[model samples]
Target: MTDSRPRGRRQAEAERNDRALLQAAREVLAADGAHASVAAIAARAGVGIGSLYRRYRTKDELFQRLSALSLDHWNAAAERGLAADDPWEGLAAFITACVEFGQGSLSPIAGAIEVTEKMRAKSDRGDELLDALVARAREAGALRPGVTAVDVSLLVEQLGTSPLLDQLRRQGRDDLLDEAAGARARLVAIAVDGLRAVHAEPPPGHAPTRRLYTERWRRRPEPAG
Candidate 1:
């Protein structure tokens, strides 16, 4: 019992440290992007640099985990949306959940981290869930004919950039933070309304493809020697 107790406590502490590190990394990266230092993240997490390095050898490793967590959040939200009875409401709910969760703020660190197979798999699954959700909405005539799943994905990404979250942290403006969130919610609502099958002119140029969006995050191949 004594041996197991110690091990369990150690595991619990390790998990807590990881959560703190991730939240700190997210905040620091959001404010400073790829240029942010590991020391900054450690300090923000109230841990020493040595402790942070013990878990993540480099900033990329840390960001890789962050990306995975973001994908997890997205996938969960997508699932919840798909389970909703109202197709349009489900889609809108998913979009709002993603944006409000600050998943979009992680985009700046995309190229900095190695896009591993696990990350790719999670992202692809997210795509699948999104495709199913969009199909449900479209078949029900809740979505505009011209809109695509990729379009909704891109729109959520665009809305996910939460600069106000950073501001709320730095400036301690909790009062204004709620106001800012409300404004964002209002914008998202308008965006959802626009996605309805009502009259609208065709968007200029062709709609963006999932391939194009995915490729943007991939590391470019090196030139021949």
Candidate 2:
């Protein structure tokens, strides 16, 4: 007679494989960005290429799922900010969290995925959280009167792209690496100070939404064969 096992075992194995694939994809994509190969991800996951393809028909589909995971991360960060007792602290935490996330897992997926309505909705929710934090901080006289949520978001994005950090990582100089690692945080602190009410000045124009920035910066889709 054939050996028998519950159907649940197969389902559990499938779930484990899917989770492993996603985790591996995140790690590879974080280091290599959108150009990272599926083969690399499969190898990292210790799964066959056929296994990955069985779960996702195309690379785009896998990227889409990764994008969703990134958005969930942002949303969770926002929730933490919203939960903070001090409005200014909450806003600062939110900015720091976003910058850190971008510098790590979110960057590749951000550049890779095709924009979808579901992704847009998640981004909008994050924006809403930002708006709330800004409003609270402004009312508390912690943030400058003219500082908009967009300003904070843009600052995080700018700091997230630090060349010094990239250069240090490339050079592999242990002595300089320690200093370079703190550079982003130091810059974030400086920027946060500048957002105080004491430095208030009118913004030149309306700040662009996160959606607009994503649309402008997102990589063009690869051509079909």
Candidate 3:
């Protein structure tokens, strides 16, 4: 009979290498954005460059895997937000989670990768959850009328930049880190307050429908010249 113990050990080692590579990729990409080198990732994982190549033949392959993981994480956070009993609270929590994700591990890779159909589908589901959150909040009179889901989406994108936090980190100003950490939250609160019905005036023009919003917001490829 063929000895299988050696084969099993090799398989287990392969799995461990894969996990290490992925974890390293997450950290490197988060810190260095799309410009992160494969060598850097391999070094971070304490794996030989040859080993990384064995697992992921190319950088694009690695990036695609990371993108998938990010999508799964985003879906989980969205689900948690939907689970909250309070609609307004749920919306806020979801926005916060999204901002955190964008500022953390996945933001750089997310924008760098080609948008696959699978990514589009996941985005559609996310949009649906956002729609429900906004609708519920409006019904409860927590959100103002005429504030479309697109508006919230835009606000979240703006918050994801984390300008103050980034600046503080870059400056290594530990004294201000605590205050900077709350900057996004404070801005979000302000935006939400501004979105209140009592603070807003009536729109001059008709608001776009959901279909229109989706069509306009969806990223399309530029036509070949």
By lDDT, is 1 or 2 better? Answer: 1
How would you encode candidate 3's per-residue C-alpha lDDT over 62-180 as one tens digit per residue?
87776666667667777887799987788778777877666245555544556667767877787787788888888988877788787777666567666566567657799998887
For residues 1-225, write the lDDT of model 2, one tens digit per residue.
Answer: 753778899789889999999888866675677788999999988999999999999888987887777778877887898899998888888878877766345565565567778977997888787788889988888887677777877777676665676556556667887687687678778887888777768566776775765665366777898
Q: How many residue pairs clash per model?
A: 0, 0, 0
Give the least accurate 10-residue stretch of model 2, judged by summed lDDT: 103-112
Off by over 4 Å in 2: 1-32, 44-47, 103-112, 161-179, 202-206, 209-211, 217-225
* Model 1, residue pairs in steric clash: none
TM-scores vs. true structure, each candidate: 0.88, 0.71, 0.66
What do the candidate models score in CA lDDT, each in turn? 0.85, 0.77, 0.74
Instruction: Kindly list the per-residue Cα lDDT of model 1 for residues 1-225, writing each as its tens digit.
Output: 455567889888888999999999888988998778998999999999998999998888898899999999999999999999999899989998998888777877656668989999999999999999999998998888688888888888788776765778689887788788788788878877788877465456788898866767876555599
TM-score of decoy 3? 0.66
Model 2 CA lDDT for position 12: 92
Stretches > 4 Å off in candidate 3 = 1-36, 40-48, 103-112, 167-176, 202-225
In model 1, which range of ten residues has the least summed lDDT?
A: 196-205
